[model samples]
Target: MVPGPVSNDRLGASNGRSSPKPRILVPEKVSPDGLALLASDFDVDSRPGGLSPQELIDLIPSYHGLIVRSETKVTAAVLAAGTSLRVVARAGVGVDNIDVEAATAQGIIVVNSPAGNIVAAAEHTVALLLATARNIGRADRTFKDGKWERGKLVGVEVGRKTLGIIGLGKVGMKVARMAVGLGMKVLAVDPYASADVARQASVELVPGLADLLPVVDFLTIHTPLLASTLDLLGEAEFQRMKKTARVLNVARGGVYNEAALLKALDEGWIAGAGLDVFTKEPPEEGSVAAQLARHEKVVSTPHLGASTVEAQENVSLDVCSQVLLILRGGLPTAAVNAPLILPEEYRKLQPFVKLIEKMGGLYTQHYVGARGGMVGGRKFELVYQGELAGINNTRPLFAALVKGLVSSISDSGGRDVNIVNAALIAREKGIVINEVHTRENSGSTYASLVTLRSYDTDPAAAGKEERGAEQIIEGYVSGKTVYISKLDRFTASFTPEGTLLILHNYDEPGKIGGVGMVLGRRGVNIEWMQVASLEKGDQGDKGLELSKVDSAVAGMEAHGSNTKGRGNEALMILGVGGVVGKEVLQDLTGEEGILDVSLIRL
Candidate 1:
């Protein structure tokens, strides 16, 4: 039997409510404990079987809050029908079925139990890993069929084996702890997590998947399914793994290529696989996932990572607590949208937020174009200069900067990259963050400035010059407009917006015309341009000509004679209308005096 709603008076005068209790609608079955807690302070209407879309739409208008699990699809239509709904809470980590944008559009807060089922999912991952390693599923099935296949059930031991974890998030970290307890060596690769965080967990931090793949006896993925991580473990990755290695995916379905896994298993590229989720839930009868489930070397389960009773109760309670907090006019801890920043402060920081985000995006893309990839190491430093340094609250701006920096190089999948989870995602990837606050003007021309730099920690490159070893980008707010003031050593004042193409070239004649010809031939229009040249001292060109000349060349002794015509490096920053294609890029690079080129889209 469903529990009856409680009166608002039961919550006492501290709740500041003399009116009727807030009405909460539970369209899907939740833990009884969660319902009882809601019933203690609010009116709850629960339907265990869950209401159909039309039924939910018809009943949602009367509720002040709605709580649901994965089964209920909170579509835009339902959100549109929810005239009085103030909050929509999901009892699980993934809100795949919830239209969060729709809820936000209606000014309804959407909350999720991000950490409630973490342990359950972690335990489930370990269970699947063990099951796959020991051939427990096959053994149990054959024994139940009355066949004694003892000799065929030989298994590998997980102890002392290397386990490579793709993401060290809440569930992933728990799995790391459990694996360590089981005597396994853990190697984690997360671009957002710092080395200190990994050291605290006793896991070796690897920078890339290639570094982790060949060494691990077991490869388990915990990263979200984004454009970068979709089909993360495909043919190439499977080929890199040891033939005796096992693969596990308890995070998401699309993380591993199902067809590739089937082929890997059939071709003996991997020993076994344990999958709790699939790209398509309840995979087609004859699909690769279904075939893999029937394979002797594979162990598969329905999506049950958070299926435990304890996990269900925890998520239900967590989300319910958030719903109650919001209804009581308190801020929620796990809100997945813009933070509850005060209006006055928000207005002050709004322009800076956009400025820093664009700066970060431009810097990362510029670095990748120059170095052929993302920044080498995980450590990054953020400096707030001039008037901006005096602001006590800069967390939101920092988060925006990180979101912009990481989102450009990685795939966020369906998850929204906002201030709330940006730092969380950054930490999961082992990205070290150092923030500096200073009130000194530092001779800045603007009232405020934000600078981001990625520290290169390569031992081999430590002895070399600093020019190509690090990345630094700076921006500032002028009045209401935001402009990028500097990039590396070249100084420029240009609005960091739209599509931009940056070129590093010799400070010689005809270079600009050559680049312009290439862009013109490709039908690309230049909206704006900024040029800056490296000073003689800045380029270390003071004694370069003298050192290069022999004593026999007496007339060449003067530095002016050797370098008067050219040699100083210059930068051309072009704001273009459309994408600068590879062909145009190649032509630009091949032009005389051109050294490097990078394109950034903001």
Candidate 2:
């Protein structure tokens, strides 16, 4: 049975002090033991049966921390209200419920218990695969119905079947190992992964989706939801699968096209399906997910992959420990979307970090310019300060930074991009990568500054540069905007979509309006625009300062409330044009305008 709510009055109690037990509130179901432990050290409060958005909005302001599961929506509103909230813990692996951007912007650390659910999700996948193959659930129902039709239920043998796995991540790898032990031949396809690694897992790696689609008797999907994977298994791809093949998805919703899948099931495009997730949850009573559950050929469950006793206990313990640590003024190990800088150090550089990261996002988008292929790969570097050694999971942030940089260029196509293969890919494409790490205890207990560089060859252009790779793009996230610190060198920025119009021209009158007018005339809608400039030798524009650009940009106090029409141009990102192979820099700068345009990648 599900748990009940905790007393809200007890939750409201706080020791009269400027610094109380950094109150952590668990609004989702957590293990009793974990809660007891937290109550001993923290002014803990917890409840079950997920919080409605408004209730969460109302309660958020009262706590220093919050915890939840997939059912809760950690929207921007919750983040805005929780001014006192220092940390948020998701008692499960996936953080799809949390608005990571909102949390990060507000300096709230978001943690997830990923390791806790791995074993359970993997084991559940195996159980479903076996159940689907043998029709165990169907056989039991039939037998209870007084129909002994053993002859009609002749099950397929797994010993000789080729099990095709779409993703080779933690769950996929576990499935492959178990399938192989059961005498099934395993073939996997993962473009971003190494074939050598798959072979090491004792599975054969096939080329792309086209090759694996028609040959397998069973297919399983395990991947994240991003631009590329959105609606991945659509109508055209469904037609490629053999009619006898069965498919399974236990990873994320929308990874499969539900409409296409239903048609496939009805049209016999595929034999059957085994699903643990859907585009929507517990699905409406007569929805496709529910309808599919009623079909004899399909096997279903209400996302039971992480429902095991062990997984729940693990998640509860993991989140409990994380909340405790953060309340004690230490950063969490499983924070889902917190930026690389430490909390204390981050406070110091908060203003600049936002500017730098935003700039880096835009700068990256400018050079790579909406192109899909790998640009002359760029090198990544990070300088670490005190206590980084304790945080073993910092690697994901590094990859996220690279992905953020790449996303600025090719929003949809650059997602699979990661730090593991980023340098290698850069090297293969003749891009150089350099890394630097520094440990110091002077500034803050824990702090870091990152720098990303790229060769001169533009990601939007087909041409190569004379310099091996010009330092075309760079930026980092640190502290508050007005008082940001010089955490890194060079101001790099990138946008997430379409050609960017980067203007570094003289910051004179009418530059922003001129640029906007030029782009508008060229049929480009200004999606989002940020302008930054330094008053000669001011606090901003200092050499080697990530915060300098943001200080300069945010410092320009608008003349009045009506400040939309004009400003000096420091940088501009446009969602101009759709997906294309070429850059459109010439159009914005060529027209009679004050801004000099540099067409960067989407």
Per-model TM against the reference: 0.76, 0.62
Local accuracy by lDDT, each model: 0.75, 0.60
Stretches off by above 4 angstroms in model 1 are 1-19, 360-381, 386-392, 402-445, 453-470, 478-482, 492-602
lDDT of 1 at 153: 96
- Residue 29 deviation, candidate 2, in Å? 2.5
**How many clashing residue pairs, candidate 1?**
11
Where does candidate 2 have its weakest 10-residue lDDT segment? 1-10
**Per-residue lDDT of 1-602 in model 2, one digit per residue for the tens?**
00112233223333233435556767777777667768877777777866778888887776877878777888999887876777788888777688776776776667787668878877877777877888877898999999998998877887889999987766788889989998999998764344445677789877677888889989988877654467778778888988878888888778888878888888889877888998788788888777777778778888898998888889989888878877775655555643444434444444433443443454444444322223333434444444442444454445444445544323123333332444443343333444444465444422443434444335455554434444433333333322122212223333333454455544444444555555555555555454444323222332222222222333333311222333433443334453322123455455443444455543
Q: Which ten residues in a row have the lowest lDDT in candidate 1?
A: 543-552
| The candidate that achieves the highest TM-score relative to the unseen native structure | 1
- Model 1 scores a TM of 0.76
Highest-scoring model, lDDT = 1
